[model samples]
Target chain A: MNLIGISINHRTSSLELREALHLNRDEIVSLIPLLKEQIFSEGVVISTCNRTEILGFPQTEGLDVNSIIGSLLQAKPIDGIKPEYFTRFFSCGAVKHLFSVASGIDSMVIGDSQILGQVKEAFEISEDLDFAGSISRRIFDTAIKVGKRAIKETTIGEGAVTVSYASVQVVEKIFANLEKKSALVIGAGESGELAAIHLRDKGVGKITISNRTIERAEKLAEKVHGEIVPFQFLKEHLHNFDIIISATSSNELIIHADEIKTAMKKRKGTPVVLMDIAVPRDIDPDVRKIDNVFYHDMDSLKIIVDQNMQKRKEQIPLVEKIVMEELVGFFNWYNTLDVVPTIKSIRSFFEEIRLDELEKIKNKVSDEDFTKIEDMTRRMVGRLLHNPTVKLRGFAESGANIKEVLTNTLILKELFNLEDFPTNGKSDAEENHNSEGNDEKN
Target chain B: MSQTITTLNVLLPLLYLTSFTVYLYDFFKEQKAVGNVNRIILFITIIVHVSYLLALTVEYDHPPITTKFEIFSIIACSIAFSYFILELLTDIRGTGAFIILFSVVFQVISSIFIGPNYKVPEVLRNRLLGLHVISALLGYSGIIISAVYGVLFWLLYRNLKENKFGLIFNRLPSLEILEKLSYYAAVIGFILLTLAIVIGIIWLPKAFPDFSYFDPKLTGTLFVWLVYGVGITSKWIANLYGKKFIIFSLIGFIVAIASLIVTNSLARTFHSFY
Candidate 1:
């Protein structure tokens, strides 16, 4: 029950320290087993670019954090590594932190979404290494579910929160299917190349890169696997493109209103997206006035980025609510694990007494009477045990303090005068008896 | 049966109101829990509405197309049913809230004023007349749908032009899709209206004996059909589209609505069989 973890994330330590202390796949593969051998019954290591966390369910309460840190440092040592750099969390806190990390809310970029897959990989690695305890497996399973539910049910991962991505979002908003569309990049500078890459990634069918210099344009076109169009024919080819992204160093507008108007005439009311994500503006702002031409300059894209970021921020509480719901579900199952054995024992105790009494009366009654007696005694035991069993399970699943549940379970055991059992929820006598019964049946 | 019709008349509008509210909730909140159930509510509402129409038909001994109020209820059901089909075909449910709101208004008006019209002409009970009226009602539903998409297209176009980047821009279908739907719906409306007019022409003389070609219903139907016909032809022949085509569709819808009101309520016409 002693779930614990330490996180060295972007918020806790410097980038240099994190890089130096980060564990790769091999290090994690070795470290999890080492942690299991030294202090923990189960362990997992989540190592991503933004964070490296080592979580475990310790076998004893007297474990040393310094020894755990030393084990990690041994795998990938760094100078001046200290315990203060790692933020520690106990049972509930560790669970919540893992859930948030999986949900992508705790990443350096809010809603990065890639962290969920990484979390899954981390869990799978631990599972494959046989470092997974029953409790740890449940925890990791719930974390993955929480991550998926957050994405499916909320807008946390929606919209574009960066400038380069905002241009793509604008185009998506204007066009229903990008696979049938074409894009023309007017400049081959960094921003223009980035925009073209985003467009290509978004499945814009054909990307044609046009630039003032042929070599730079050819390089970008090659990178995006696109065609290269001469810069001089940009306006003439505009009519063929569904999207025109212009980013350049030109102080004046590279595209004029008349050129766009001519393009619109040829497009026959088919809409076009004109993205000008460059400083000092590249496409004419007057293009906005033309019908069926959707235009967004750098300032507008920034506005969209801001709005999307704000929208993501608003979804924080919703994602947190999902995490808490899943966390409660996990704890409910965890707490019930304790009460399950007790419930089984109570049923077994009453059944043994009922069967013993039935045997004593077996010779004194007719066959029909004996069958009736057996049925009556069985019903009596079931009726007598139903309420207590139901209440005990309700208490366990109520998500109250585990200590309270354990105390109630202990009291029930004492009141019943049941034989002492192991904390693993099974006794040696029960195991021996069940095996003998199975052998006889075989 | 009359009691059942009365009860349904009261329940029909409430059901539509509930469906509209669910759709509106999904539109603004965009919550998965609500969005997933939006169509279920619409489906249930459509079923209940069809049942209501059946009850009216049983009670009155004719299809629920004898009076303007009954026809209004029929139109309400038609719009909801058509939108459901469109949603299924295109997998576009984002505009359901706006589309279902029209059904709510029409159903509410019909539910408030609907009653048995026992004096309906014998000609109204003819199955041909029923088909003609039902086709005309469905045609009007298409016009309304086209107009709705046109207005949405205009709103989104303005938002993109002015760089609003607000909720409407984010939620509405793209301009091209809206325009395409609008144009498509207009085509459907023109074809259905043409069927209604042809049926009317076939049955008019047999029923009226002295029926005039200048009957307000006939002339009104011709006018609405001509408007949509011209709009569709312009698109095919002159490649007319976008804002110009949307404007044309809206104008056609307005004329259709105006003509309906005039021919039904203002002018003297044998079309009002009751």
Candidate 2:
């Protein structure tokens, strides 16, 4: 089968656009059947926060891959493919892209390394559907191996890549030592908990976790060996802590100037470090003005994150080299698809001839003699064809295009009069997004 | 035979004392070599110091950490050891090195001026005296480390406010780090030092009620406790974090160490120059 891919990713779309294309598991089930009704479908869809893509092994040539894309996207195919956002790659190019992504070599944060498992799940879903093609099978496994190798050979995954890690670094940078200090976490959200864990490792004497939901605060506190502080008690205890990290989803500011001032009075002019990870910002901006309080809000965090993204971008060329080598390897195997069927059919023709010859011998012999004749003929055929068949497979595997000469000469028609095998192994016309003119390029 | 040491026997403490002055200079100036230099000097001094203690050991027929001079040196060693641990925990050893050096100097001074001689007071010749001296000194070492970092905080803070971007910032921790380190050391030292102070109070009258309450030991002991106590409470309730608390700690530790030297002067008559 001929293969092709179409994708639109985070680089091209906003969150609104990504959500528009999101497919639930049940939706995928029903959508596949509907897509099958419109065109042949040996296909898999990958829908994640970053990208949505379709991988199809089409059964027929000259099918419009984009005609089927309309079922998902808005407007005409050409306009819908905003040059900035969408890309199309065929066969080998598609395989390489899949592998790099599965390996997390293509991640915005290189070696963040979550994509391998995500790719595995996608493979499993396709396997359960019994729709996994050879290219899909080999590339995914290789991608996972490459992902692990990147981690092993390079320090790619070793350092702090996440915002959470950087946040901890900032706190530790200021406090010189935090072992005896108490730390207060204002929210029990994921980011807040992560900050707490980082502090806990620093040997902060006491950790206070307070969430709007007391249960969550208690649970998170228990894991980190921290105490559960009541959300209301935060102001009173604010002066008690050396550090405060806020990640609560509060619309209003959680700690205002007035509250901080009171806390400051209790603190005997000792400074408090405040880190606000909340989106709307839990700590009032004015709280920053309080002498001895160091306040950093979400905006500051974003600047750090943006800088990290730039740093990751600098690592891309190295990853791209790996992607290119793997792509070339996949393409060599892909381009040799033509010779496989020729080798298979040549063996089949020889077998047919041996059987036909044995039937003739049977007609000339008695019933008991016919059985002996059948066994002898079959053994002779294997002895004659085994070497040539093995050699032909080897030749095909080594990138020889034997099928091209065979097709041009029409030797099978002249000798055995057999029709050639159909060109592609899959049916991908179901949602063909290709136009007629595009078929000539392949 | 043990070698004879004269008034210049005081030079053993002098070696350590002069080193801290270099460190304090390096603290605000060429800050990079403080830890490395201090470590090398401390090692050499400790080796020589152990010999000094050994000579006194031979005279006393026991570990000579009891006498004020030997006790001070031992306290210096304890400060150095804690500084060693601090170095391991955090690489910000530049700030803590000065305090360790200070401890060494004071301990050496005690050994030279108070109990440099082989003779010890009969009242001071007990196992409890060793326990009291060693424990109190070690705890004082922690207080000393914290106070030094506190001084770093003051330097860093003032420089930041003055917007000097000065030399101290380069060598020392940012005010934040100083605050944290000082607090951590204060808490640990306070716990241990408080214990030593309490035991000494209990044992004092029995051994020598003549050791007056107004004596340098009483004042010095109380002063050390107050300084350490203030550091701990600042962390808990007072907005005492960062540079301010650290500065207070530095100043407090300085007074405390000086008071301790004066207290050691009480053991003057019995000890002779070796």
lDDT of 2 at B162: 36
User: How do the residues A326-437 of candidate 1 rate in per-residue lDDT, one tens digit apiece?
Assistant: 9888877777777777777777788889989999999999999999999999878878887887788788889677789989989989998766433345542243223332
Docking class of 1: medium
Query: Which candidate has the highest DockQ of all?
Result: 1
C-alpha lDDT (0 to 100) for residue B150 of candidate 2: 70
Off by over 4 Å in 2: A1-4, A10-27, A30-43, A56-79, A82-85, A90-95, A103-121, A133-138, A141-286, A297-299, A310-442, B1-133, B144-184, B191-222, B229-248, B256-274
Instruction: Give me the candidate number with maximum lDDT.
Output: 1
lDDT of 2: 0.65
**Which digits, one per residue and each the tens of the lDDT, describe model 2 over residues B1-274?**
2443343346566757665666666665443335377556656666666666666666656666644455666776677668767776886556644665676566657754664345545666677866876677677777877777676676666554332433453456666667777888888788878888787888877887566666556666788788768766865775555655666677667777687566555444212223
| True lDDT of residue B140, candidate 2 | 76
- DockQ agreement of candidate 2 with the native complex: 0.23
Worst 10 residues of 1 chain B by lDDT: B27-36
Question: How close is every model to the real structure, measured as TM-score?
Answer: 0.81, 0.49
lDDT tens digits, residue span A186-222, model 2: 8888898888888787688889999989999999999
Docking class of 2: acceptable
Fnat of each prediction, in sequence? 0.73, 0.54
